[model samples]
Target: MGNLTNAVTIVTSASSGIGAATAKRLAASGARIVLAARNEDKLKGLVSDITEAGGTATHRVTDVTDPDDLKALVGLAEETYGPVDILVNNAGLMLFSKWEDTAVGDWDRMIDTNLRGYLHAIAAVLPSMLERKSGRILNMSSVAGIHVGDGAGVYGATKFFIRGITESLRQEVGVGSGIQVSMVSPGVIDTGWADKVSDAEGRKAANELNKGAIPPEDIADAVAYALDQPTSITVNDVVIHPTN
Candidate 1:
């Protein structure tokens, strides 16, 4: 394993949950962090905390669904900390709904944020990384992508899309370029996401599913491990879940 000393990193959806945890973990490892999320107050607080802890950090209020916002976010990172060495695509939505309910709105939200958002971030960073021929892109995926669960069909589909893109990126860029593409798939992380589900029956199901939840820090550690590697070595994929 290699250490992350002064590695410029960008983490999306860093206001809470896995993104926040991952940002903290990487910052503690001596990485310069640029946090992106829609919550300005929370982003400011997180930046303050990281700075207070002797880590380099900054944030921009961003909506991942917006391509222009992603461009500005990457530009901010570049202006503040030089070239981005790592991009953590973690901004996402997981609204659960049964197919019978036909919650088209929730599905669209999931696709917009979870699917398009990831692509936007990747597009913003990949070009510079390709030019430098060195960088890391870690896509946050879900176990739902591999194994479909009840009431989470569209959410699972987005993750499946993530899996496909991550693999394609790895093969296309990693083989020739010095960039490393990785993915982390977590199951039932306790990110307070279950309580945020809007659908009544979906919320009930989410709550039931979250009973076996693991802390977000667990996934954070996994992400750190995946990234703290030399360029010659590629940590392709890590799947984490609660034993229970």
Candidate 2:
């Protein structure tokens, strides 16, 4: 836990939900957090809230789908605080529709945001992290990545890609580089993500799932745990599921 003190971190999709909660939790533990999201106003508000609470924070409006935007985000963290010691790739989109009914545009958006976006962030930061020989990358996946559900075929595929990519990257980085790559798979979280479901039945089902859903803060605690571990101890995967 003390290892987190004064550590620099970047959390994407940080305007709300799990990303926001994780940013606050890390700040509370003495990490200087950089919040990245598409919403500038929300990012600023979060930064203000953390600062008012006596925790250090900064932010940049970022669209993770854009490689250049990701590069600028890393630059902001470096210039404002220092080199980022941790990167939490938490930004994602969930568009649920049956395989036969899914629109091409929606499918493209899901792949671009959920899969390619993670790749873009990794590419933007890996050079510096590898050069420095130290860093932690925490990718937010989901239980859906493991178990398929109705109307979530494409969304689940995207998350599955995240899991696969993170695992392979972990092996590639290995134990010697001082780089830790971990994946967090949360199940039935209480977030407004259900609003994005196109099918009314899917939306209702998601709402029902939320009846026993874990809070975003629970996942935040998991992220903090991974970040706080000793440099040599890499937690490759963490799954947080609510007990119904």
Give residue 93's error in model 1 in angstroms: 0.7
- Write one digit per residue (lDDT tens) for candidate 1, span 110-221: 9999999999999999999999999999999999989999999999999999999999999999998999999999998988998878899999999999899989999999
* Winning candidate number (lDDT): 1
Question: What is the clash count for each candidate, in the order shown?
Answer: 0, 0
Report, for every candidate in turn, its global Cα lDDT versus the true structure.
0.94, 0.89
> What is the C-alpha lDDT profile of model 2 across 1-244, one tens digit per residue?
4988998999999999999999999999999999999899999999999999999998888999999999999999999988888999999888666667656777898899999899999998888899999999999999989997777788889999999999889888846777999889998787788788666666776666668878999999999998899887988888887877
Q: Report the alpha-carbon TM-score of model 1 versus the true structure.
A: 0.98
What clash pairs does model 1 have?
A: none
Per-candidate TM-scores read: 0.98, 0.96
What is the Cα root-mean-square deviation between model 2 and the actual structure? 1.4
Off by over 4 Å in 1: none
